[model samples]
Target: MCRLFALTSKDPVSPMEAIKALDVMKEGHDGSGVGLLLRDLGGPFEEMKDAPILSGIFSEEGIRKLDLFMMDQGFMTKYKMSIKVPKQTLEGTPKRGLYLLRAYEYPDSWNVDTLDEKELATRLMMTRLKIREMGEEKKDMIVFSFWPDTIMLKELGDPMQIARHLGLDRKDLKARTIMAQGRQNTNYAINLYACHPFFIKGYSTMTNGENTAFIPIRDFLSSRDFPGYMGYQSDSEVFAHILHYTMSGLDLGLDAYKHVITPLQDRDIENHPDATFLKHLKKSCRQLIIDGPNCVIGTLPDNTLFMAQDRKKLRPGVVGGRPGMFAFSSEVCGLDAVIPDRDKSKDIQPMHLDTAIVGPDRQEVKICRQTEPLTLPL
Candidate 1:
């Protein structure tokens, strides 16, 4: 099994806090790998908010090839940050090429004003696919997350050890939101793509349990003809893609996620207060449902956060925080590690029927409890 931790703050906080929380639950994961995703970034990235940040690791040769590809695409790097994570700093970690975070402007003809969010997002995904395929061919370069407001870093080692290696232990690489997973390899080879906190466009997710429904969900997503939906090295990646599909493709509301993944029984829906729409929603998206023992913590476009547990609630999870901030984690101890001083009286371990949503607005935490039209803020 793996462990998951996510921290959403009204202000910038380091990824170290979330990684350290994973350390608190060290026994729960084997720690063969670690995946970190930071969005709603602060620090230097905040200044480059309009630029798309391309994040990946590349060997010297791969970097040379990558530069050529970017130039061919008519993209120009406005600024680049080369992260030199020395091998010596990571005692037991596997060595790889330097990790890079570079911001780029759109192709010469395609100005930012003319390209909408989806267009730029599509371009980033296609570029990422090129990088991923290149890496697959020779095994040196792998691109992780590429969107307007996020950066992803993944590695094979203990979370603490990886953080120490990157010197994140001593620095605050700030982001308003951050997620880290202590990955326990279950199905595929220990490939980097198999790590949690998977992203496509602006949506991202990290899971703490197995996805028994992966095959059907993957098939459904791939059928969408969206390039980003094609890759599924990790079953949990579907969780992120599905969220994107629900939000961008179907134009469904946030509550649609719970409905699609763990829809209510027809009988319950028939009796639901909003039966007309509830019935239509379940019938329309039945193919996207998930069967599990899985719990997922994720974010949508606007720094909106959510946590969902399967109908069985097989994996543990909790949501708690004070005003203007919140945490949705696989365990409560993680919340304690991050928001120890927050009001404990409001802590919630949502039942299987609940979907804990933190925002379209970040002022309060909202829980959609079992199809009741009412939403109560915690």
Candidate 2:
């Protein structure tokens, strides 16, 4: 099994805090790889929130190609943060040429002030896909995310060791929200694209268990003709895509997400006040049903953090923290390591029918249980 930890705060916090929590639950994951996604960025990035930042690894040739491509597309570099890797490679880590997080100004042809949000997202996603395709043959560049106010980093090695080597402890790399995963490498090759905390557009998610229904779900998603849903390097990547599809594509409310992925039995559905809608959703999204033991933790475009369990609730997860800060971790010890001053009594371990959500306000946790009447949050 893998381990998942996510933290959201009113103020910017170092990603190292989340990494330290993963260390506290070291036994749960093998030292195969680590993935981190930071949103609501702070420091220098705070001022450039409107700029689209591209986070990835690139070779010398890849950087040259990227520069040419961006210039052709009329995108100008606004700010760049290039990490300095030591000459001596750290043990168990791959030798990477350049680790970069560069923000860019909008292309000259596009008027950002007049463009629709969806159109803007499509343009950004298409640009990222084009760049990824350009580097696929030689493996020269590996792009994780191209979004505003977000940065993604992934590498092969121990979480702490990788963090130190990448200079993640720097004060400038802080964010108000962070999601991390310590991969176990149970199945699939140890490829960087297979890392958790996958992102597309503004949705991001990390899982702690296998996705038994990956093939069917993958085929269904790919059939939708959405370019952003093409990559299935890891089984858990579908969780993020499914979220984007449900919310953005279908225009469904957040509460409908858990119901769509894990619908209730016929008997239970009949008792629900929204049974008609639930039945229609179950029938239409039957292929999207997720099987196997898993716990999904993710953040929405609004920066709302949430954790949901599978029907069997085989995996472990807990959410706890005081006002202005909240953490969703695979184990309680992970939370203790980060927010020791939190009220332990209020810690929530969502069951099979529950989804624990902490809104963008960072005020309190709201438990949305399947048994209760579906009420969409405002």
Candidate 3:
């Protein structure tokens, strides 16, 4: 997360002053924005456009750094000057655009510094109130913002599952926001639909709030205290369903979110069965064994390559999970490799093999190979 900032006071400060205060503290934040929500003292609420920070730093003595990133990191830039630039020319023609239209038009532009007393009194106040109302209603407002990473988006999937587990459809769940770390080397920050109004990382004032009900996959599937997942190989949706069931069955808080890592461990199922919502995740393991032996593999619809395949040998094996991990393979070799139990019933036999690791999202990697009906260690 780049930074976090928030304020609640009877009398508001100038946007310029607010920007200067936050800039001084911003660690390495490349960009910043502000969300203005105004409540008319028990009357209708509204919000204004998110303001951006200019390409300068502020300190006790004034702007400490200048053009560090060399980008117009401020709310009003060459294009957004109308909102933050202030109006010297006035009258019927008006020196600037209407506050509401202007705020929404340049939703991405935010610079707290350029705003003056006149702008704040006439424009900023009313603008903030409208923006706040929208934020409260939709709950998807990007108050102050920054980009996100893949992990954060995947993490969101967990909360959606949790909502479904509790019988809440995608539409029924309350509003929430998530943070995504950028992929390339850029200042990272969380994106949110905020209501409570808090600071980003530390200094950036944000409109988006932490509203998601889901937990990270690692945390969600960490234990066997809940019913785990089971599904056809190569089907992420099915895996999600089983996970939802496990969390719901165990009564692990209806609104709670859970997460599971890729490539589940055998011990996750062999042990800790009593600790999870779904104790008998392996009951469906036989399907992998029954379908395995030899097969050809292909990519998913998106064809983005999300996993690495490891096929040591074509072996007759069983497949299960750490409760939340699902098998994904052309035949079932991948499943056998992960969960090999050759005791109770082993009707299927392996002859050749092909392996590929896929998902978490959209990617795949192939590794190793095999030949002949092989026996695997349980």
Candidate 4:
């Protein structure tokens, strides 16, 4: 098991808020690693939302190589900010190099391709793929995310220790939206890439349970011509990819997320008010179905946050907080740590049939459930 915590608010807050919350659930995680994502960025990143931030780590030699590579690829750095830790001691992971967070103006073509955003996103994914693959043998550099309006950090350590290492003290690292995960390694080795709270161009997800449907999901994604779908260090990573595939790849609305991940039974579908469409979804994209004892918390490109539970409802999740802030958690204790005095009546623990959505500004909160069957013309 792992601990997943995310908080989105109208105002900027330090990463410590998430760190402190995760610390409360340390029993569920082994302090193996930490992945931090900040969006609706405040502090230094506040004014630079238009530029794509390229965040990852590098070695001394790797830095030079990275400069050459980006220059060759038509990337020019617009602004840069980074934190480098020396002699890190955290769990069983060994320290190898320096980490950085830098923002760049998108390659001119991509920046101007506003009409074809997915094509641009695919370019970004392919670039990230090159960095991860080519940098492997030399272990020169690793880039995590390259997107406008957000920054990501991942490292092997206790969440608190990693927080300190990040210098979260000043508002420099503040953001209105922050997500964190305390690692509980159940799959691949505790490599940085395998860490929870995975991110793609604009989509991100962190899970607390294993995805039993991994192989089929991987196969479906791999068959796509895109380069981002090949890596599967964590089965839950596919959750984010699947989210990307469902929403961006197919231009489907958010409701399709449920149809693809956890569909209704034949009887349940026949009985559903939206049966016709649901049945069409089941028949057309059956490859996306997820077999789970899994519960997921994630964000889409628009920063619309959501939470979902599998059919078995095996993993625990609770969503509750004050008006300006909504917290998504894997347990009630995590929510209590975020908004301890939250109204008990307003607390939401979505069942298998429900998906909880909180808007970008906390303006509204609603539970999206399966629609009732409707009578329609044949």
**Which candidate leads the pack in lDDT?**
2
Evaluate residue 262 in candidate 1 and report its C-alpha lDDT on the 0 to 100 scale.
Answer: 88
- Order the candidate numbers by TM-score, best to worst: 2, 1, 4, 3
Mind giving the per-residue lDDT tens digits that candidate 3 earns over 105-197? 223353325656334333433333333343444332212212110001111112222122223222211111111110111222222221112
| lDDT tens per residue, model 1, 21-52 | 89998889987889999888887778888788
TM-score of each: 0.94, 0.98, 0.20, 0.94
lDDT of 3 at 131: 32
lDDT of 2 by residue, 1-378 (tens): 888899999999999999999999989999789999999999999999999999999999999999999999999999999997889898888899898999999987999999999999999999999999998999998999999999999999999989988889998999999999999877788999999899999999999888989999999999999999987889989999999998888888677789978989989999999888888889999999999698999999889999998988999999999999999999999999999999999999999999999999999999988877775432
Q: All candidates' lDDT scores?
A: 0.82, 0.92, 0.23, 0.81
Model 1: pairs clashing at backbone N, Cα or C within 3 Å: none
Model 3, global lDDT: 0.23
Clashing pairs in 2: none
Per-residue error (Å), model 4, residue 241: 1.0
Q: Residue 303 CA error for candidate 2 (Å)?
A: 0.3
Angstrom error of the Cα, residue 367, model 4: value is 0.3
Query: How many clashing residue pairs are found in candidate 3?
Result: 77
Q: What global local distance difference test value does model 2 have? A: 0.92
Error of 1 at 214 (Å): 1.4
